[model samples]
Target chain A: MDYAARNFAAEGYHTTSVTSIVNGLGVGKGVFYWYFASKDELLGEILGDALRSMREAQRDAIAGEPDPARRIDQGIRASLHWLSENRHLFVLMEFARTEERFAPIIRRGDDQMVADALPHVSAGITAGLLRGEDPVFLTMAILGVSGHLARTLVLEQGNDADRVAESVIAFCRQGYLATGTPALARRSA
Target chain B: MDYAARNFAAEGYHTTSVTSIVNGLGVGKGVFYWYFASKDELLGEILGDALRSMREAQRDAIAGEPDPARRIDQGIRASLHWLSENRHLFVLMEFARTEERFAPIIRRGDDQMVADALPHVSAGITAGLLRGEDPVFLTMAILGVSGHLARTLVLEQGNDADRVAESVIAFCRQGYLATGTPALARRSA
Candidate 1:
């Protein structure tokens, strides 16, 4: 699965044939068919595994964290770490999103992410730790920032994951305003 | 070009052949070859046009804006509006990024975005209107938030573009912290 995923990420998923995967693995056609029905199924399984593992990482990172805000912080850090470590899978997921056949799977994972993060976001808002915006919107913004930064800064630019995570967490917690400056009342108005 | 872009965005890029594009448009293969040398060339032209138009929108929206912070806000609004308007091209861009052959074109456009936004971000920091973090990183975070939110909220959820843009700008400007809360000093520590 790892080898196939790397190949799919490196080569276009459509371009990477079952023949190539089996050839690269030094396995017969029978061996390939015995494990997976088709290349599409294989890619689906890879994406599923990647998403599951990522959710697990986020869950483990925030486990037992008492503060809602800190739980979100830890979740962002853990997500970045997972994305950096599984850069190939990250690429694959992006590619999968572009295809109609695989987009539903990606959306399911996105829904799951929102479901997982909603409670903490809601808790933070209730505790006055987060902005008084829709919790769902806030959760999406957090995911967007962390995911985008991970792709651009960490994966593409080779930045340190921990440093990027710190920046992301700080941005999520306080935004772009300089310290001591009055928080812009644009929204309140 | 519009027809081809829509087809490519609707069907997978790899699956959408030049013949199909021409047939869908009721044009002969000769017409397609005369205009675009290949399917790859056609997709490249579509992406280039989309990026150029998006940049132009941002430039026009920020025109005559004196405050760097307001310019950033205007830029985000313009970008979200453009993305919502041209969602098919946006999906095509995402798809193009996954392919090795087309990824460089996307990267060049991304580099141009950074160049365009860097001055505004730097000026904001210098004026003490933005955070003291790396200007480039801040810019990327802004882009990430806006792009991701547009995809999730406006495009997928069918939210109003203006409202989504307002939320994104607010998040980028002040973050998730509620008004009057001391901006967390986690970074300082």
Candidate 2:
């Protein structure tokens, strides 16, 4: 999957033939076909695997957090940490986003990400901790902020992933936190 | 340039051979060569034109704004409008970002974007109208947030780009507005 991801990421989807993928891995055609049904399926698997990993990390990050705000922070950090560790797949994710055939995978992952974060965000709002935010808008905002910051700080600049997470928390607090507790937003999610 | 942008944006950069571009236009290959040196250079030109258009929109949006906060709002909205109008090419931009060869153009555009927004961010801070911020970090965060939001809301969803821009502005204000805002602590950028 890594090999395929790197190839697809390096070469656009239409350009990266299954032949190239197996040949690049120095494997026979039969070996490639034995495991996967088709290039499309193979790419789908790769996408699924990436999403699973991200979800797992998000789960692990927020596992013990009692506070909604802290859960948000942990989730952002986990995502950034995952992105930092798995930089290569970001390219594949990037490629999947453009082509029509692959958009579903990207969309599914994004939707899942938002769904996972929904409880935390909603909980904050209910507790009068965050703003009266539209869940979709906040989801998109979190995704945009976390993904971009991951790209800028963790991926490109090699900044401390922990520090970047703090920034995510801070930015979210600035926009989402209700009036009070200017130091670090408290949460009940 | 528009012709090439459409082709590359839709068909993609690598799949878009010189032959396809010229043939699609019902022109001889000679006509293509007459204007551009090679396929690579043509792609570069298309990208440059896109960037130029976006920059112009941002500039025009902020043209009459003296207040740094309002200027940033205008800049974000103009950018979102450009992204919304050119959804196809915008996807192409993200697609193009995967390849190394096309990276320099993207990077140049990125640098210019942050640099363009920095002066306003700085002025706002110095005038005690905004939060204390590290200019580079703040600019980068805003770029990350706005770009990500633009990609998700304007380009992908094809919804109200202007409304999304308002969200970006509100986000920036929450993070950057120095004095007139209530306590919302812990900003990332």
Candidate 3:
């Protein structure tokens, strides 16, 4: 899977051949087919595995934490740590997002991410520790902050996970703590 | 440019031929080559034009705003409005980000976006109205928040600009107002 991921990340997924993946690993074609049905299937598995690993890391980090807000902090840090450690997966996911064939798979992963974070956000809102904004909006905003920071600080600039995670946690926590109406002030409505 | 933009947005850039671009508009191939030397050059122009338009909108909205925080608020709304009106361009830009050939083009636009928002953030920091976080970090966070909301509310969910902007502005303002040290509390650092 790592070999396939490396190839897909380095070479465009559409351009990378199944033969290249097997050849790169010095493995027989039969061996490759024995595990995966096709190149597309392999890509799907890679996406699934990456999402599972990420979720596991996030869940493990937040386990036994009773405070919803603090769990959010842990979740952000865990995500950044995972992104930092699996930089290649980030690149692979980026490639996957552009293609129509993989967008649904990517979208599912994204939705699952939001779902995983939803409970904590809901808890915060219920406890009145965070703003009473639409939970989905808050969740996506938190994710956007973390994902972009991970890409900019950890992935591109080679910064450590702790540093990137700190910035993400601080910014997100502040956003959550603010009091505001989620509805827009539309004129001529 | 709109013709080419629409075609590229609808059909993936890598799959869309220059011939198709010209033929779709019922123009001679020379007319296409007259203004641009290659399809890649045309893609760069499309990106630059979009960025210029977005910056103009942001700048115009923030003009004459005395308060740094208000300027930031105006900036976010302006960005959301521009993005709401330019959804197709987002898809094109997403495609551009994945390809190595277009990463530089996208990176330049991203860096320029950060530079444009930096002064307001720096001013807020100096005035002690906002957290004294790294200016780049703050700017990117602000952009990330706006961009994500724009995508989620405006693009995917088909929500109005005013509605999405309200949530983004509220969240960003709170983050900016929070007092926290930007540095991570690294153990054994």
TM-score for predicted model 3 compared with the true structure: 0.87
**Could you arrange the candidates by TM-score from highest to lowest?**
1, 2, 3
Candidate 1 interface RMSD (Å)? 1.5
lDDT of 1 by residue, A125-183 (tens): 99998998889999999999999999989988899998999999988888887877765
Model 2 chain A: weakest 10-residue lDDT segment is A180-189
Q: What is the lDDT of candidate 2?
A: 0.75
Q: Please give the clash total of every predicted structure, in order.
A: 0, 6, 0
Could you give candidate 3's per-residue lDDT for residues A28-52 as a string of tens digits?
Answer: 8899999999888999899889988
Candidate 2 residue-wise lDDT, A70-154, digit = tens:
6777788889889988887876888778767778789889888989998988886676666665756776677778898787778
Model 1 lDDT tens row, B95-150: 98898999999999999998999999999999999988889889999999999999
* lDDT, candidate 2, at A143: 75
By DockQ, the best candidate is 1
1 against 2, candidate with superior TM-score? 1
**Predictions ranked by DockQ, top down?**
1, 2, 3
Worst 10 residues of 1 chain A by lDDT: A180-189
